[model samples]
Target: MTYELTRDRVEHYFDRTATKVWERLTSDAPVSRIRETVRKGRAQMRDKLLSALPADLNGVRVLDAGCGAGQMTHELAMRGADVVAVDISPSLVKIAADRLPNTLKPRVTFASGDMLSADHGAFDHVIAMDSLIYYTEDDIRRALDNLGARTSGSVAFTVAPRTPLLMGMWYAGKAFPKSDRSPTMIPHGPSRLRKTVSDIGQLNDLGRVNSGFYISQALEFRP
Candidate 1:
């Protein structure tokens, strides 16, 4: 078991949570709130990614794995990258499709499915933000391996740092706000993640997600 529950049940809980998140994401008030919150951090996130991103995103095909609400996916597409945003939550995918700009819709697609199970082909880039917190360490390692195999350029993601006390606080906060209902998963520190990436020998921790809440950024490649 990853946390205190099985993977199947965790998936189910997230599927349900996705429904509520989708409702908020689609509503005008919530969307406006998102636009405001994202505006504060989006630029930094984009800049960090671009620092390691391949120079040519134009006409490049990209995959946004675990693309909650499709915020980053839309940004990539808007920058001229053909994007496919994937999530295990169908309702979340629906909101992503709806919130996407009509002009960019042709270049951006939303899919409700597991990234590992999907038929996503080789891509120039793959991004996962605040989305890796749901998996066990073994699964995260395996997923990184698989993502590297599927992407030619880079596989990037943000994960919460592993500190027992910090994790406890973060977990408690998420629960207090009645935020996450999924099973608790172990958080990883930057050192642990760096070691994992080094062990794979295909990925490199080029940068980090500096939003200041125990998050790190990692990049991977296949030799």
Candidate 2:
């Protein structure tokens, strides 16, 4: 199920798909309204990070790793924290800047680059919402280690339940079917997800919800 990893092909597929998702999730319309659709979802995302957040993060630097469109990144800043928003795609970074409120823009530092490579070590918190799904188990292990290195207190990330069928679709979606290149890969079930998370390190499973079969949201953190 390997598809050509051409830059144009990869970027084109993600740019369109991400835009569609962004519209659906952020729209003010009735049916597509994310806030209405997922009651308490925002609190849930906030809670995951809050559970392990140190008591002294008011002025701490935060890294919004893989901050697509800056939705969650904005939320981080709204909480009175300094945020360094980052994404692999230039287009997403641009959109994030545009989406930000003019007043809050000063608090956000948007950078376009790989989260694993970015010098985010100065930050106190590192958040990977709906990210960290792209790598294989080995890759995920390495990424977690890297993220932990840069994090001052804890590292928070979300992973999807991965299965054989889902894994195939994930790869195809990346190369052929052209799905969003996020929530890249994860365990297909809750048990496997828990095991994977725990095996890497002591992680508190924040809980799980139906966030689309291809990308279920289950927050895990090492504190």
Candidate 3:
């Protein structure tokens, strides 16, 4: 099935799978080999993102752009940072909001909107997580510019790396029956992404996590 990358479709895709997405990110027990691989890769990505954060986040202002289900949002808040979490899917935002602990409620504000257009105000740091995979190269650049403009410290994000093997796997996954692939899973190269953020900050290649056929790269931009 050919999947069209439309706003409505993207929202629908995530909205219906918000719970599953949350489980995939937070689950510790894997029922199958595929699940284990996915869990390990996601954990590595989350670790890389967290490691890039400042050593001291007490009272820090953070923007969790495209914070689907708010896993990182919760983590940041737990570290004593006030977090403004935003997502394009209303259901996902709701899921994130509901998942927050009562004490952390005051530290987090959940908003439903596109990160590229949302005015989340200034923040000490910003994290986009696995969100940029849904955007085109030009749009990703614009999003990076917007995020950079609102942060004083750094901006961290993950992307589906563009490589012959990964590109082939992406296509194969799309061609499979009943595939749960996102319509906007466009792969990007690290060099091209660096050029896009060149004017905003200095790019640091954090590293990459391999999950069988797929690879997710983590990058940080210091202003």
Candidate 4:
């Protein structure tokens, strides 16, 4: 099973609750100190993943899975990769398209739907950012397997790393009444993820990025 229920929740949360907040956060707009830290952390993580790819991507096909607002998609296209940027939220996808530079339009395809859709065609590389942080291990493993089968090169992604501060937040967030809660982030350790998706590829840790409330660990999986 593809775990449709979890994905539905993810899709709904991003489309409804997070669309506007994320648009502002990903842009140059000023946000709260905590969110500002998150912005910085995300920028660092984005650069880290990009560094793993070949410097020149002429003729490369890249999938910007869960490409919120298209920042990663923009960068990949600028590197000469034909990028398929897919996100679950149509609203965010539109924002991504709107923000995309006209010169880069020919290099990108912005779509809103399942990022792992086989219909997107095979890819040279895949960048998933923080998109996989909400799913279970089973869901993540299945996603990596699906991507591994379709991708010829490395898959770079992020997870909410298991740490003391985040673990506390995880527990505290759960205390809220069900209706008030957004999609909860599932924290995974780098070591655990290595074992969880071991069958798909050779996984390498790219260290952790922690800026205040934003704590994510980047990993590169080469199939």
Candidate 5:
């Protein structure tokens, strides 16, 4: 599928189907054991993504692409980075803006749009956690190309690594009715992804995190 088509599906899934559940899942509210594991996994992934960046972020400009509910975005601003947190879901973006601490407001600009939009301008770094997992490898590379062009430092992103467990889950989830399914994650082989971005920049294997059903590999690209 083309990027725009995939983006439309993603937007519809997040905005119409999963917004409330996603908001709850990302919050402190009680959830089922399965969902709790997902929450834990996401937290680990966030930390892994953040650890790739510099310790001191004062005066730094960062892009929080697909900044769902703004957890990572808040963290970046807390560390003193000027953040433009963009997401495909307007509902989630609103929640992110509303949930942001007042003190951090001056450091963040929240918007509901394509994360790769050039209007958001340049950045010192970019973090795209759980954002590019749905795209094909080619689309992911295209996204990195656009993001890398605007970033002076590096871009940290995540992908749903193709593994036995994840592949099984993907197949099982396929049994669900189309009406009930959320946006499906396109699992990627690490080597293929790494090699595909060869000309974009220097790619680093940052490591992977697995917490129950949530599994993702983190990578950093420096230009």
Candidate 6:
């Protein structure tokens, strides 16, 4: 599938799954065992992402690119950062906006749009979380270029590892078929991802969390 089509599918899937995604982000008690596992895995990924942020976010400006359900966006605002949270799914964006506390509403600006094309102005930090898993290598490079232009300090994102074992698992999922509505993911290994961001800034490997079949690799780039 084309990148645009894949992105559309991802947006649709997330929009449909917005409520479940919110629960997964906030609550540990998922409806099913599989969902419980997913919750644990995503929590680990969030922790790794949070660890890479600046120690002091007081008055910091942040671009929460692809900020699904405002999970990280809320955290950033709580840390005293002024956040511009952007997501492609309108439903998810609305959910995120509604979930924000009344006091934090003033500190956050929620919008629905493609992160690469949006003009969110400048920020001290740009975080994409687990959102880049749908982008191809070229698309990822383009996104990094856009993010680098807006960020003055650092950019952080997560990608699914492209290892043989993980690729096998992905193929197995396609064979078994969980649901016909699942979104297509484009996995990128650490080496290729490092090269994609090298032109824009210095790449730092934050760490990787192995979540059974796939691995979530956290990376930060400093300009």
lDDT of 6 at 85: 95
User: What root-mean-square deviation over C-alphas does model 4 reach?
Assistant: 1.3
- As a whole number from 0 to 100, the lDDT of residue 171 in candidate 3 is 81
Q: What is the C-alpha lDDT of each candidate?
A: 0.66, 0.63, 0.78, 0.90, 0.92, 0.79
Among the numbered candidates, top lDDT falls to: 5
Root-mean-square deviation per candidate = 4.3, 4.7, 3.3, 1.3, 1.2, 2.6
Clash numbers, per candidate: 2, 8, 0, 0, 0, 0
Looking at model 5, residue 56 earns an lDDT score of: 87
lDDT of 3 by residue, 1-223 (tens): 1222455556777777555755455544454676667667876787789899976688899989878877888889888998999987887788788878999999999999766564678989888888877667777777677777778888899889887886886788768663456554778898988887787678889999988634789988776
Model 1 lDDT on a 0 to 1 scale: 0.66
lDDT of 3 at 79: 88
How many clashes in candidate 6?
0
For model 3, the stretches where C-alpha displacement exceeds 4 angstroms are: 1-7, 17-25, 28-31, 173-181
Candidate 2 residues lying further than 4 Å off, grouped into runs, are 1-12, 29-47, 50-56, 162-184, 188-200, 211-215
| Candidate 1 per-residue C-alpha lDDT over 49-102 given as tens digits, one digit per residue, 9 for 90 to 100 | 655666557889888887766777777877788898898777677777888889
Q: Provide TM-scores for the models.
A: 0.75, 0.72, 0.85, 0.96, 0.96, 0.87
Task: List clashing residue pairs in candidate 1.
Answer: 162-188, 162-189
Q: How far in Å is the alpha carbon of 66 misplaced in model 3?
A: 1.7
What would the per-residue lDDT of candidate 4 be over residues 1-223, giving only the tens digit for each residue?
2467777888888899888899999999989999999999999999999999998998999999999989999999999999999999999999999999999999999889999889999999999999999888888888889999998898999999889888899999989975687888888888887898777778899888988878899999888
Model 6 scores a TM of 0.87
Q: Look at candidate 5 and tell me the lDDT of residue 45.
A: 89
- What lDDT, from 0 to 1, does candidate 5 have? 0.92
Q: After superposition, how far is residue 64 of candidate 6 from its true place, in Å?
A: 1.0
